[model samples]
Target: MKSVHMDVHALLDAGVIERRAAGFILPYDAVHVDFFLKAG
Candidate 1:
């Protein structure tokens, strides 16, 4: 999970990519992630 967190942090830190929203979705008893991003 730490690696994933770091990757997301890197994206958030980038200037060109905007992080609009992010969340987790639970389906089939598993965790799925959703990220909304926009390009500058």
Candidate 2:
């Protein structure tokens, strides 16, 4: 689970996603991976 958190942090740093109170939320839908990746 630590690795997953690391990856999520990387994604947020890359501007691929944003962190929220609920969890990670994708800002755009241009990429296919974001749709399948759930923020928890």
Q: Could you estimate the TM-score for every candidate? A: 0.38, 0.61
Model 1 TM-score, all chains together: 0.38
Best by TM-score: 2
Quote the lDDT for 18 in model 1.
Answer: 49
Put down candidate 2 lDDT per residue, 1-40, tens digits, no spaces: 9999899989888998998899779888678653456689
Deviation in Å, model 2, residue 28 alpha carbon:
0.9
Q: After superposition, how far is residue 16 of candidate 2 from its true place, in Å?
A: 0.3
**Candidate with the greatest lDDT versus the true structure:** 2
Candidate 1's C-alpha runs over 4 A off are: 16-40
Model 1, residue 23: C-alpha shift (Å): 4.2
Q: How accurate is candidate 1 locally (lDDT)?
A: 0.57
Which ranges in model 2 have alpha carbons more than 4 Å from their true place? 32-40
What TM-score does candidate 2 get on C-alpha atoms? 0.61
